[model samples]
Target: MINFTLDQWYGWINAFLWPFARLLAMFSVAPVFGESTAPSIPKVGLAAVIAMVVAPTLPPFPALATSSYEGLLVLAQQVFIGMALGFVIRICFSAVQTAGDFVGLQMGLSLATLYDPSTHSNTEVLARLFNILAMLVFLVFNGHLLMLDVLIRSFTALPIGHASLNPAAWMGLAELGGKIFSSGLLLALPLIAALLTLNISLGILNRAAPQLSAFSVGFPIMLISGVLLLTVVLPHTPSYLNEFYQEMLGHMARIADTFAAPRGGAN
Candidate 1:
């Protein structure tokens, strides 16, 4: 004999559906988990599994029919929250790629690009290389686990169906977006300065010895120097990436708090 009332069914559904919506939205944008080449079925399944695990811990859902306007609005809020959080982490990878682009341009490898399935666009060769390294660094530091933990904590900070997201949160996200350039430039600065000095020296040599072809001599020298510099630079990069991930995790928490706070209130 099986007896299940409609209210009980709604309770079960509410416990799972909203959380599932948020998790699915997050996986749609998060790095590695969200890669375009990855099959969609796994993402959906993983979201479902996580939603099942998280549902029991969630606070009771507000009294609203799933098909009602208010319920839909809440659902949209959850999706937005998930996507925004995932995007915040995605920015970390973008910063690394940006640094690579700067270095590659300096090294005359700007034209050497490949199709990046994750972005669905062509990216500079060095950018792709840096992205791969960043992915590895992220895994080494258990960033994926941290990301999941943040998502879980977000329920406590933002909750389900408390839908008034602060405008300042969006503003903050926009501001954080600007870090792609600033952080990237900082990362590439040492190499950029060295390469600029090398180019200057090459220019002076060319001026003093007009017989030496700049194209033949300067190009090879620059290429070799860039390779050597990159080898030296990369060993130090994991440390920088570790710090960057820690900072980004802090930002994620702050953003969740911002998302939960009342408009114009201190977060």
Candidate 2:
């Protein structure tokens, strides 16, 4: 008969639980896994499954009781690490949404809003459309699988109980968030420039003929021209979104670098 002491049982239980906690924290907030529309129970189940698979192979886990003070601190650190990793990907996905927002505003479609289950709030229609497209592209690139690979590898790069996150790395995340405005502007640039020139021409025409209501006539023309310009630009958006995704993954690794241990694995 195999005899297991109380401490060994505790260690075994905790080994599975600790990494499970981190996985939950991550998937709960990370993109499609965390989308407001997704039910919570499935996310928990998925995390549990991954933990079971991953726990056995992990290096010896710290024997910290889930209820103790030290254990609480460790739990908090794991959550922090999870949020940091998930947020990096969220920032990347936001780039497309940001671009769509600019295009919508320029096209006078700002008033067209939809209830976005992903956010549980009203979002611009164009942003939502772009979000759908980005999702499709993400799947095409096998990003979901890549994310799972990264999660497993993170144990090696940022093993349990060895958490020590550097604060300086947050600056990098802030910079990532800031990319929304600049990149969005770049995405919408062709339309914005074209619209500006159109508006100028309309202004000159209005000056030449005061009787015609320039506002009424220019609105339809701008709308039509914006549609044309959007069609012209649509072909190029996939490449831009692809590049942004790559950048997001790079930054994700960099931000976590502050907290991750030096270990070799899929990340």
lDDT of 1: 0.89
> How do the predictions measure up, each by TM-score?
0.96, 0.90
lDDT per residue for candidate 2 within 61-153, as digits (tens), equals: 787776788777877888877887888778766877887788788777889899998888899988898888888888788777777777677
Model 1 weakest lDDT span, ten residues long: 5-14
**Weakest lDDT window of 10 consecutive positions for candidate 2:** 258-267
Question: Model 1 RMSD to the real structure?
Answer: 1.2
- For each candidate, the alpha-carbon lDDT, in order, equals 0.89, 0.79
Q: Candidate 1 on 1-267: residue-level lDDT in tens? A: 999987777668878889998888888988888888889998899999999999998887887777779878988888999999988889998999999999989888899899998888999998999999999999999998999899899999888988688989888989999989988888889899999999999899889999988778877788899999999999999999889888888888889899889888944
Q: How much lDDT does candidate 2 score?
A: 0.79
Backbone clash pairs for candidate 2 read 157-261
Q: Cα RMSDs of all predictions?
A: 1.2, 3.4
